[model samples]
Target chain A: MQYIWINGNSDQGVSPDNRALAFGDGLFETMRLSGDCISHDQLHLHRLMDGCRRLNIPFSQATAESDFKLALAVVESSAHKFWRLKYIVSRGATDTGYFCDNTVVPERIMLLEPFTRDVVSLQQHGVSVIPCRWRLSHQPALAGMKHLNRLDQVMARQEWSSSDIFEGLTADSEGNWIEGTMSNLFVVDKTGCVITPRLDNCGVAGVMRHVVMNTLCPKLGLLVEEKNISTFESADEIFLTNSLIGIVPVTRLADKTYKIGQITRGLQRALNTKESGL
Target chain B: MQYIWINGNSDQGVSPDNRALAFGDGLFETMRLSGDCISHDQLHLHRLMDGCRRLNIPFSQATAESDFKLALAVVESSAHKFWRLKYIVSRGATDTGYFCDNTVVPERIMLLEPFTRDVVSLQQHGVSVIPCRWRLSHQPALAGMKHLNRLDQVMARQEWSSSDIFEGLTADSEGNWIEGTMSNLFVVDKTGCVITPRLDNCGVAGVMRHVVMNTLCPKLGLLVEEKNISTFESADEIFLTNSLIGIVPVTRLADKTYKIGQITRGLQRALNTKESGL
Candidate 1:
């Protein structure tokens, strides 16, 4: 966040009355920026635009696409090859209450940081995660959109400070398995069918999840479907996905150890091929 | 926000990486300021501290009390007798993922705005409301704390745009009546028992709600309790509460008009007396 831009300008901060800060009335996309090109830029754009539309923020994908490109151009001079680009669109500054004036402009905040991770990206070697005690609220209205109201994620992540754990598997209020703290969850069952939780209840419908389901799964001739997954105990393999981390296989959960299954390795290889093509 | 203070300083803005903007990982207190005094200052302080503790933000009531006082003192010279003081406490600036540094200090942002309302207060002659189509999610972990994630309220308030409507009554995902978009709702039943929706599931446990339940009701010898209220048709009287607006009776829900009952008038009088004493 040291290098930040609000609506393509440096130095100027987000207005105090911005709805993002007040009510978390906003949407955001965190994409991996490699040198010049953005990974899954199109998918990220679609999700952000969809989120803004769901939240009733005045923004179009075409406008956001130009803004994303403009943001990349605005920071063209930066020498870092890898950066975590966080683009936020909030219902901009308003002095009113929950009732927003229809004509209020939306805020576009882009934060760029040199890509850093405390948890090693053991993409092939895999990472470990524990079940989170924090539960996500079930709101079909706000679910599936990557909106800014993520205190549930924050709380879930706060459960463990030990760097030993990479992520935490979270469940919704009704005890249905949902996702990881910062990544999307995928469970490979004994029958080898890929399973991800239904985002129609509660969870961020991540761009990478979309890629795995729509792009990679079809490429590999695999059956990937969303269902109410309640346990990882019966899984033959487990993994997590995010635009930043690509695909991270879950090698262990609590005391149980899991081998990097062939399917996971295949998906990982497929993701590498896909990303390289991008 | 024409006038704002970030930890008592003027003309300064919150850092771009403030968690409030990023994840809504913060707490806020919108207290009413009159001349030089803050209304329901103690209750707001209590709730703020409780929320900070619940969210794991490093803030105590004593520090917040001093900060709250300092903010009041810092803006002592202002001529506006009535101000809507929006005090926000975020997990401060952090350039990390969902995880946070334990040493990061919580930010104290105070925004001052001239209190203005488009809808009439109509405290004596109550206001009309409509049921919101948007529903609240049930999260016991976050219930009752006025944390920064208010997208539900924003969506609920978006259901209507007419100035004729005061506030929209919101219900939980299970179709249980919860509260208003900006206020806590209380319903007086046929038996004269005052019932407010329980906040243990989901909904803001506003300070005025606390006062009406703990102070005014007890003072008037009325039986007030929390329950799962679903409809307004059976209610003998309906009312809403928030710190700034105090207590506003609901005279009509859609087409059904209701009389300003004796219980509502008595409670309103009691609240006035209590505030005068303060």
Candidate 2:
């Protein structure tokens, strides 16, 4: 990473007793930075604040914005055009126990690193994915908060080491298709409708997933359905979305090979031109 | 805590990029130190190592033992007779992401603090607990490992602030009684049999719980059963077990009051004298 900030201070370390390290009692946001601009900064902040409310962590958007501005300035001054920004707010340090003092001030850590993803090429050619054997556990209390308890994702991502496979798809224990290891999943149907799995039980609610569901799909007159998706029984197209990669089309899953359908291409075009405002 | 050690070095802080803080990608053991001796040292180490194997974190028992000895020596020279020691081994710092480098040497952080629990009073008079409204998620992959994804426990424990309530009992999403907020649950029946929740789907497989099932229960001529326990149905008596607190009899759950039965007492006696080697 080019720069690091802890609670608005430029530092590389945190106390050992920080509850984020202790119990994963925290929330985080990973955003893409092109030049001095952070993509969907407001949406990311809103999601983070919502997560803080759910986890009962004290969060001030004003303070976080100030910190983000400071970190962005550092990144902009560097010799890098494309960078990744990670913002973490933990429940501060605590005495060794799960019983947290809710009144403690939260600790904020921001990390900036020079990162580049070949989004154009990956989106154009599409990527291959595999269904992971490791299933996600259903916890409604923590289902979509983007909180720090991400061992499930870590384990699922470890299932494959093939450089050809861009991502791994995961499901809940009940065999309901959820999302990718790091991004949200969307399947286009024969009637040109977009179907993404409901996040009430498992999987993270990604920021870009929210944008597509609320803005991009509706603008294209496509009916977006959030329901329990089974396997790719009749899917016309499959794509993934995240803040970093924006939209990644999945062309292959195991034995099934899919062509880059019309809806996937249109969404990608809109995302790059009009919707993303890049 | 008066003293802290990180990776065998006496340091108080960790890198901001540590995986533990980023994703709660770590395992920890909370141990008790009494009169310069660590309680259930072997059991704790074994549990930590088992967790390491499950999470794929690099661990060396010899290195951990040596570090523990060094930290214990520091605590031994202190004035306090009773202290709480927390040993945490994270997958170390990484370039911010969930995908881990298995080759990275794990970071060990040991925290020591003066602590005392009135086990005598709690055992003699028993304690009151309530069924938590928050339920544990069913994640068999992460179950029984005591990994750091503890937002479930943190939320459940936040259900009550009353000092009168000693602990909260939690069940899985399917309504199967799992464990206490910080301890494992045991229900004793009129037939002099002991039953604890099956942790195949959820709950931590505690070190002391293992000791009770393997050693204390057999010594007391009690048949131990690990099954899906419904909330106190046919439960003649209920008690909790953990490494720090050996046996805590649950005298009350909601409005249902229980007496300190013979099985509970016998097990506690055996634990303190024979099995625990206190």
Candidate 3:
């Protein structure tokens, strides 16, 4: 597990006062790599930059691109077919307080590791999902962005004890289905329209979610509605999507069970087609 | 600023991967120092240890005591009359990835920064505060404990303008008053009893807030109720509390302003007596 720490552009040893470690004041992006190049690199970069801008962290697009490319070089050198790439931008040394310490620019760290495809997989028999006990907090300012403060997901993931259950559905404070702990949730309504929970107040707008919203939904002429979804009561055919797993069919959710509906499978095929550059 | 890194007691350079930085999955404590020792050191340690126990992060009480003593030693050597101390306990390094990285031992780091009395004293004049647009999500499992994932505070604080507002108050998604960005809020009701928003779902149960409830409330024979507060309209006289600021009276909110009520000042004086060891 090799790693590189770049303070903006220059490489340096780790420091003790990184605010990311101090207050978890940071943002990160984990990318999926194929042939030593990240898939959907542009989309991931766009999200990362947007997060940095919102958080007031100094970001150089060129530096991040170069660092990411260099990390891919390390991964390629290792001869791994598929790998995971992570970019962490941390608020560096400052005047020693909770407030912004502009003295130290953001720290960029990229690490490439062997991707474990076996651990996370689209369930062949279909994934069992549950309505998690935890609910996503509605923080509009932090919502739709992936930041380092993820105690919510950590707690949600801990609620599941069985590996058979691939993912769990989460609700916002109002008991509306929001998203999964690490994936974006979608459901096919009775009219064949795909509905995803609006992430304006809670939940992350995942890169895969963005791609589907921007590309496949329009391309397929599917009526995609971003509205409040109550999976506990009204979801027709629930499914989950993430960069790692393209699409997963949610089979059993508590007392109710969903079949591998045609709409869900169709979207999966469409997304795979897009990924394959068809 | 001078710094040191230690792994279990021995001085060591930074490890290849720190789980605290990786997952923001850790516990931390910020302490106010008086002379050479931290104010209410034992209580802070108790909270830290409690946080670790909740997160399953192993805490070495003896090691923590030694590390805290070391941090105070550096402050003792400084010429500054006041100081701030921070202690972080991470889940230590892992091989890689979120799961299966399985290093159970916690990594503890202590940092000391010297300061002047003027910095904290400015809050006495009362710092302007605003209600953050972002609302805290209620996740009882992760609430109350002060963990490393504090992006909510970071985003809420970023809403500040340079207009010298000392802090911002945040609410839970259900519109229940939580706390100030870095402090706890209490208000005197019309009946002269002190009321504070319960931290059952979100917000840090601040050490100072606890001290006021435990010592001053009892000594003053004032009723303290932990209930869900809706808005500032109900607060007769609101004041904020933290270890750093002994008591900060909120004279104005949005537009409504109240004089520092007699009961509020009485608790402040009584808490000071306990703090100053009189």
Candidate 4:
């Protein structure tokens, strides 16, 4: 990392009693930083605040904005040309238990790392994905919030070590295709209609996924559907999205091969235009 | 907290990049330390290793044992009469991402706290509990491992703040009674049979639960049954167990009141004998 900050102070370490480490009691946001600008800063902050509310962690938008500004200044002072900013809000340190004192100030850890566009080629030619044998447990109580209880994702990511596999597509225990390891999945049918997995049960409601459904797709005159998608057999195209790697098309999954369809390309171009403007 | 140790060294902090803070990628054991000995040290270590295997965190028994020994020594030299030893093993610090390098040696944080025995009176007269509205998500992949993704428990614990309620009983998403916010639940039938919720879907397979099922129950001539226990209507007695609080009888839940039954008392006596010998 080029820069690190804790609760807006320059620090690289956290107390062992931090609730984030104790009980995965926190939320985090990872955003793509181009120069001094963060992509979809408002949306990221909105989601973080939403998570804090649901998890009952105290969050102040003003304080977070100030911290972001300080982190950006630190990044600017560094020699890194491109950056990936990670903002973590944990329930701070406590007196050695799960019962938290809500009055304690929340701890914020901000990290800025030199960006490496590992998926640049994958975005262009599309990437390979595999069906992860591990199924995500369905828990609506914690669904759709980007809290730190991500053992499910960590286990899914460990299913494969091959560099060739860009991501692993995981299903819920009930056999519904939920999402990719680190991104949201969108599939296009032959009729040009878009469908993404409904995340009411389990899955991160990614910021990029929100952008595609609410902004880009509507602008392009496409209707985005959210449902329990079981099979990719009916899909004409498939892609993944995250804040850092806006959109990545999946070219192959096991024996099935997919090509970059027109809708995928059009969405990609639109997203590029929007990102470039940012 | 009286003392803290990280990787066998006296330390109070961890890197912000530590996977435990970032993703809650860790497992922890809260063990009761009586005098110079940690109660059920073997069972605690066994469960920790099992958690490591299930979560794919690299674990060395010798390293963990040595760390535990050093931490115990620190506690022994301290002035505290009673102690609680918390052993945590995280996937160490990594490049900012969920994708881990399995070769990285896991980080160990051992915390020593002066035990307050906050529930001593409750253990005698029995404590009141209420059913939590927040349901535990069912993820078979992460069901039994006492890994650090305990946001479910934290949220459940936060549901009630009444000092009269000592614990909250949480159910799985499907309405099956699973466990307490911090302990495992057991129900005894009038026929002298003991039933604990089947943890195939969700709930921490606590070390104390293991000891009760494997070692103590059979010795007391109790046939322990693990099944989907949906209702406590058939229960003649109710109790909870954890490493710190061995076995806590439940006197009341909502309007339903229960007295300390014969089987519950028998098991409690057996546990007391075992603990006293330790």
Q: B33-80 in candidate 4: lDDT tens per residue?
A: 877888889888888998899888888888888988886786788877
- Tens digits of per-residue lDDT, candidate 3, B132-251, equal 886776667678888888877876876775656778899987888889889999988888879999988889989889888888899999999998889666678888988877778887
For candidate 4, state the interface root-mean-square deviation in angstroms to 1 decimal.
0.9
- DockQ agreement of candidate 3 with the native complex: 0.44
Scoring each candidate complex against the real one, what DockQ results? 0.81, 0.82, 0.44, 0.85
Residue by residue across A1-278, what tens digits does model 4's lDDT show? Answer: 46888888787679888899899999999988776777899999999999989988878988889988986776677776568899999988888777876688899998988787765676789999999998987888788999999988988999888888889999998889999989999999989999999999899999999999999999999989999889998999999999988888989987799999989889988898877722
lDDT by candidate, in order shown:
0.84, 0.87, 0.75, 0.87
Q: Where does candidate 4 stray beyond 4 Å? A: A77-79, A118-120, B118-120
lDDT tens digits, residues B65-85, model 1?
776676577446777656678
* Candidate 3 chain A lDDT trough over 10 residues, lowest sum: A5-14
In candidate 2 chain B, where is summed lDDT lowest over 10 consecutive residues?
Answer: B269-278
Whole-model lDDT for model 4 versus the true structure? Answer: 0.87
Candidate 2: tens digits of C-alpha lDDT, residues B45-94: 99999998988888889988988897689777888767788888888887
Docking class of 2: high
Which residue runs of candidate 2 sit more than 4 Å off their true CA positions? Answer: A275-278, B275-278
* lDDT for each residue of candidate 2 in A149-218, tens digit (9 for 90 to 100): 9898988988888789889999998999999989999999998899999999999999999989998888
Fraction of true contacts retained by every candidate, in order, equals: 0.85, 0.87, 0.46, 0.89
Classify candidate 1 by CAPRI docking class.
high
Residue B275 displacement (Å), model 2: 6.9
TM-score of chain A of 4: 0.96
